[model samples]
Target: MPPLNYGTFFANFNLEMIRPFFKERIAFRRKAPRRMPSLAFTTLPSLLLLGSFTFFLAPPARARLTFHPTIYEEKADYLDTQTVAVYHFRNEGDKTVTIRKVRASCGCTVPQLDKRVYLPGETGVLRAFFAFGSRSGKQEKKIRIWTNEKDLKKPYELILRTEIPRAVRFSPIFLHWGRGDTPITRTVNAWVEADSPVKILSIDEPAPDFSVRLQVLKPGRGYLILVTPRDTAKPKMRRIDIQTDFPRKKPLSYSIYCSIR
Candidate 1:
């Protein structure tokens, strides 16, 4: 070790300091050749693994249960003895579901569910039968189904309506005459039409105190039925049945309500 010039000493010191850096650079270059391409390929697989993990950890979506003919109905005009069929429903979800029960608004309306548990992508049938015996005018009915799914708890609904036409024309469908505890006389006006001439075979009331009289306002034109209650009758609600025969037609029956008060 001899005394050295300032520049020479400085140069040696710098070379010594940079020697390890150069070796590290060379080692890194050799170890990581094609770094960008390798890193890109490695990054894609890592991202895919992360995505798969996330997918496996996620919860599945809930199943949805539904009805076909979401609404079922019977019209008021349907014959009293007629039965209407409510078609089946299709399930569009990916899981199994069940309809626990089927119900109707009234005994006149009956409901039938084919099966309780339904497989994914299957069809289920529900039939509603309505018995309209002696029922007239506008009517409404409903069908409700209970299900396991929360969203479909109140699952089904149906509507029905009815309309009736008269075979003979009359000013009032119902008539109240004479005196009770309340008003003496009250009348309801109604009209009837038929394809052919119709006649009033007979008029009768179950209560002896209530009487009905048919007046031929115009021969073959139409008739008015005057209902009269005896003055001694007490105030009460009553119904009267009217029976008539038409030429070449089935016997007809009509009912009227009277409020004596």
Candidate 2:
């Protein structure tokens, strides 16, 4: 106690103070059997699974042009030589697009567009002019368009359909006979469409090798032509013209082919 071991006294005092704190911590840990799980380990797999489902199952967003009423159908008059088809479209995308080309299925159908480039939300029109040009009955045409859209695998197609009325129709316009066959007469039938009635006026003089006669089944509506080869001894061919009274810039005419083979 006189010179007193001060170092030993301080060491023993520090050990007594820390020992109780460590003892309490150890007793608390021993009383708890299971530790609380980490939120990271528990929720990470669920979040990962939800993210995978959203990535795989969600529909992709497309940025491209859109067309309204992609198909058009109309009835063309009998006298109409040409008609126009209109298509309205818009750039329903986030970026600008440029139309590369426009093509038609046939030469008679011509496609027209105003400009090549279009901005987002901008709209435009495409017109296709189809010329009948002696074409009749039901007609179908397709116009294809190419664009610089990233996801476009094939060209966009626009369809045009129309039924053209015919002024006249002929059945069996061609008649033929074998070289050594019977010289029997073959009949040709001609009828006018109800919408456009035309009278069969007269027949042009046929070749000397054939004989032609016309009998009007119904005046201005229907007719029958009887044709016979004068002689089937040798090969010969003749075209007989049937004149119609249908008023036009040039008189309407139809032809029948007669051949001996």
Instruction: Estimate the Cα RMSD of every predicted model relative to the unseen true structure.
Output: 8.0, 10.5
Ten residues in a row with the worst lDDT in model 2?
245-254
Across 1-261, the per-residue lDDT of candidate 1 in tens digits comes to 987799986766757778999999999888985735687789999999999999999877544755556654444322245567666676777777787877888998888876789887888777777776655555667777777776553465655444443465444554443443543445544344656566666666647656666776555556676666665466656777666665353577667766554
Question: How do the residues 13-62 of candidate 2 rate in per-residue lDDT, one tens digit apiece?
Answer: 85767998999999999998997889899899889999999999988857
Give the 10-residue window scoring lowest on summed lDDT in candidate 1: 71-80
Q: Judging by TM-score against the true structure, name the best candidate.
A: 2
Q: Local error of candidate 1 at 59, Å?
A: 14
| Clash count, one per candidate | 10, 0
Model 1 misplaced stretches (Cα beyond 4 Å):
1-66, 71-79, 105-107, 151-154, 158-185, 193-197, 218-221, 233-239, 246-249, 257-261
- Model 2 steric clash pairs: none
C-alpha lDDT of all candidate models, in order: 0.64, 0.87
